[model samples]
Target: MIKIPFIVSARAGKLLGRENFSNPEGAIIELVKNSYDADAKSCLVVFDIVFKIEKDEDGIDKKILNNDLSNIYIIDNGEGMSKDVIENQWMKIGTGNKETEFISKDKRVKTGAKGIGRFALDRLGFKAEMWTVSNDNNGFNWKMDWKQFDNSDKSISEITADLSDNDINIAEFLKTNFNHIKINNLFNEVSFNTGTVLKISNLKDDWFEKDIAGVFKSLEALIPPKELNMSFEVNFQHLQKPKEFGKVETAFFNDYDYKLTAKYDAEKLSVDFVITRNEMDIDVIKKKFSELYKNTKAPYDLKTLENKVFKYSKSINELLELEVDENNNKLLKDLGSFDLTFYYLKYNVSLKEGYPFKSISQKERRNVLDKFGGVKIYRDSFRVRPYGDTDNDWLKLGARVAQSPAGAGQRIGDWRVRPEQTAGIITISRKNNPDLIDKSDRSALQENDSYEIFKNIIIKVVKEFEVDRSKILNVFFKHFKILNEKLRENEIQRRAEDLVNKIIEERKVVEEKLYGKKYNSVDLFQQKRDEEERKKYEEAFKDTFKAIDDEKIEKDNEEIVQIRGLASLGLIVSSFAHELKEIKNNFDDINDLENIYTDLVSNESKKKIEYNDGINIIKSLKLDTEKIIHWVDYSLTAVKKDKRKRGNLNFIKYFDSLSQEWKNVLKNRNIELVIKKDTKAKYLFRAFEMDMNTIFSNLISNSIDSLDMQIKPAILVKQHF
Candidate 1:
């Protein structure tokens, strides 16, 4: 069978120009990218929607232009194209010019490698006027009506545009409708003589000030911050009055609360993360912390670490070794050096309780959150679209917040910055990371093996940072727990005192009735009655005294229970605070592994490692969580009221179960724990498990403490019949 050849029709332009960009901003950005590819140092966008006011017949103010035009103009000072270049390069659909010449004469990497930037004009409007003068003194002036390309009746080759070859007088061209256009202001620079100018009309979209502002912001983030060789400025004219046109103000990654610089070295196999808090905010945070500490009476001063920037470094293999198998570990050796710089947004006003800046309500706080929010990804200095969008949560931050353990400080819920709560970007360079390339659209990174690897690494590093923050906060807030305990003690004692007073008052009333002299009777009957009343009074006195004693005993018991609870809680909190101090160890290990992975992968050998398996992390996290739970359980048990109940226990079995608990630790310590019966004690013993466990625990702790420094630390549990 013979195959019929097919040719692309002129209608294909409809797809390229109109459908290539997802939005108007995207379309406009494509033009900016074109300018960048041309090695332009500046690109300006002017909305030709000039505003005017005049008097109406009734002498009232009126806005001019009932048509409400929303035209747009893009001008750039770059190496413009000659007539031949325009005809063969710019005019041709799907030309390979940009790909063939990936680097411009100025050495700027070509962002518009697809060579279809002209389609962006189609996305803008139906009609357009273009003027360009090449550096070689040749010029091309053209006009295109994109609607002609949509005619199905015509063949693909039939689509045409008005064109000419001449010295482009940009002023004469733009002055047709925009007579007020400032020629000197736009084309005064000698370098700008040979550049491109696009005057688009028949406005497609009804753009508002907000829309223009959005476009302005996107342009600010378009260029790479690290590409010092490629310096470009973007200006926009939105309001037309006495003329309000200016450069777009961009917020760099450094314009954040926390600036984190993380680097993984290939040869050194080491990871270094430097955390710098915003210098301006140090005093505010430190004051808040100091006040918090004063309230709870925290022991150590954080001032030393507060103002100082922290740098922690470790080997990568140490972090990832226990996480992956030895054979698969080789895969990590191929990774290269990568730098991840992260910025974080702090609340405009600290929402912390007891802070001076508490004027904002919850709803207002959300408004602030919207203003300074979104954690985004930057690959080679350019943003990855949809990653940090209002709808996007690449980190699933919302899910994490929801799943965070209950009873966490409200800060953990509301104040903790989610991806949306953060306003920052991670900068990665394409030169160092060749494997992680941007997609043709340049909107995001290609979801290849490298992309997945990068994403996981980022998440792990961020999670570690998050944990570090929590650990720090836990230390600061420990005092609050102490303050709460004190308040609880005062309350519990007040209740117990009232209960004891009530018992005493109740007994006093019975004694008063027994001794009352209101009763009168005949001599004999009265004497007998008095005798009986004396006996009754005696019994009543005995019972009443006993009741008072019991009430006092109960009051004292309650006080003891309260004290025990507070002490237990203090122990747990103290241990946790200490652990938080050492929390760096856990994450330092991970960092160590990360460095090794980087060194191995980035080494000359180009090794490969499988470090994406998160199971090890899960296992480690689970073990830590279980330990915390056990601490809490012990605290809760200390305060429980019904723990003195008797239970029959098989001492042998109990010892066996307890021995199993220490088996792993014993093995790790190179010691064996042996449990034996000193005698044939077969009979069951009635005792409180609480008391038994307490006694056994003390003995075990003592033995372990003494054996800790020994060559082999062993524990022996025996039942002495």
Candidate 2:
């Protein structure tokens, strides 16, 4: 065999850089991730905006003009490259030292397995200057103009980047703590023992305020979640006019009305996704609830309702957990169980001054929330690009909600909560999961079953969360109603005061009568009139409050009955998945499933199973189909009440109905749910049927969660007379 030297094409950089990075922001993210893999403690992205002001042909006024010259500098205090490494690893295309060194000095798993991050610098601009200092050497510098890529005659091997060992300038710079300020200074004099810097000039495109803002937001997403050991600070600045850009402080994810957390099992299954109630908000809610239920008597048990206030436990500020079903977790086995935390500002983002919020304006804070809001995916402490885009609804939340007719009605209510309303990050570890493969180009995750299942799980969980939230937010609506009632009371009081004044004027006129007996009679009549006015005003105030309460109850009832369709959809999908799993399991036992079908159609010699088996298979298929239909009917029945009716409900009958609904789920999970009343009393209690459903469902859900953690689990739902 004759061996020949391999020749690489010159257009490789164009293919790797231009085609690899979906956008400039995508390229920037790769470089930032490179910094992270190097164990960076802090990364600074300096957007050195250049400007020139000159008077136009008219000499009176100065106008700002784009010099068409702006530089982007990314400096990181990470492990820097040495001279030899620059030639062998840094300059090499589609290859890097990260593969051999799979972990950092901090034991962080390396994410640059494909080694395409070198393309990031190329993606940023046509010209680049790299200055790096490592403990192995004093300094190493490299400069390259990518215009060589335009030459059709040259191969990638023919296109050699010029690199040099700069012991004079860079060594002195490193010796001076990386602080050698140039006369035309463009970057900060960062003091670090070892670091790397990339100055990208002659940018591929113009850098505007929006692009800078987008870059800032993207950089924020690049920083790994605080829960990771790989936490780093990212800060951006304007080199020309820093003050005009304002003080850009590094911020952590904080401002939120609701925080949701999903805890997964060892199998990467989402065991529970908790939509938590803020304890501070809960405390205020408790006070308001106390006022509402102060003396509320028969037909409504305020004590029981108060106990379940906003799904909170009796403890101070503890999170209320939303228990997930086992069927929802089957696909997570190989996906690697990870934590996904989401923060929802909801409509409450408008609230005034609090910690973190007090320092920032409402506009700036809103901008931050809107910009950063999306479910970003992270693998081995590095973010996957394009998944959290404003235009990309990876979770398909809006589509799913809009499709469901149950979601506040398409005619009057706007129930669409877009992906931007929520900001979240999912932490997935590569060490634990070998199946999660970052694509060759390192642009996105592999489009496999694991990814599809992962996406499905999140949307389903979120849909449930939205439904639960809609119910909980009714508390705020009720609070608003109370405020409106207060306003009405004020108006009624004003009218009563005006009437009282008129009566007093008449009394004054009557008392001015000449005769003493006549004056006394007029005074008595005036007093009687005053008492009637007082009585009338009290009755009017009472009636107005009663009307307000009636309105509140009616609205609450409407919300519960017209329940969000997403919740039902999520459950339907969950049940459907379960049925499919069962069908597959059934088929798995039949080794001759394919042969059985063939045998039933023809007079074949020998098939593995008899023709009768085909009939059984068909019957099983029909049964599962009916099971799916049963659940669909059940969901509709649960929410299809024509009108809100208030009356006594028999405890035994209600529990029986609830148990029947959950029997299959309980049985499938090998869980024993025993529903026995404390007494033999056949007592009936006053409550809406919908209220009972909420209470029982939550109880069942919590019990299921506890049972999942046990080998043999049981729950007792005992009601007292």
Q: Among these predicted structures, which one has the highest lDDT?
A: 2
Model 2, CA-based lDDT = 0.63
How far in Å is the alpha carbon of 142 misplaced in model 1?
2.5
Choose the strongest candidate by TM-score: 1
Q: State the lDDT of candidate 1 residue by residue for 324-403, as single tens digits.
A: 45543443444456776666554455445333222324454455445434666664345567666664566655545444
lDDT of 2 by residue, 1-721 (tens): 9999976678865686677777788888778777777877767676776656777788766535253667787777787888777888777776746767788897888877776677787888888988888876577778988888878678887887778776534333533532323311323444456788888888876666677777777766666756555566665666554644432233246666557777555453324655554423434545555565465552123454334322221110112132455643444566666667777654333353221111234575568666666788877876777677665567766555545444322222334455556777787877766676777666678878777766765665565556555544444456555777787778766765666667666765776764443434457886797678767766665676667768999998678655645445543554355355565455443446555565657666334366657667766765565565445545645643321356888888878878887776676677877888745677687778877787778988987876655576888888865
- CA shift at 349, candidate 1, in angstroms? 7.3
lDDT of 2 at 630: 48
TM-score of 1: 0.58
Backbone atom clashes (below 3 Å) for every candidate: 22, 3
Tell me the deviation in Å of residue 459 in model 2: 2.2
- Model 1 local distance difference test score: 0.63
Deviating ranges (above 4 Å) for candidate 1: 1-6, 49-70, 153-158, 169-191, 208-214, 220-230, 239-246, 253-257, 264-270, 278-307, 314-338, 348-372, 406-417, 429-431, 434-443, 498-721
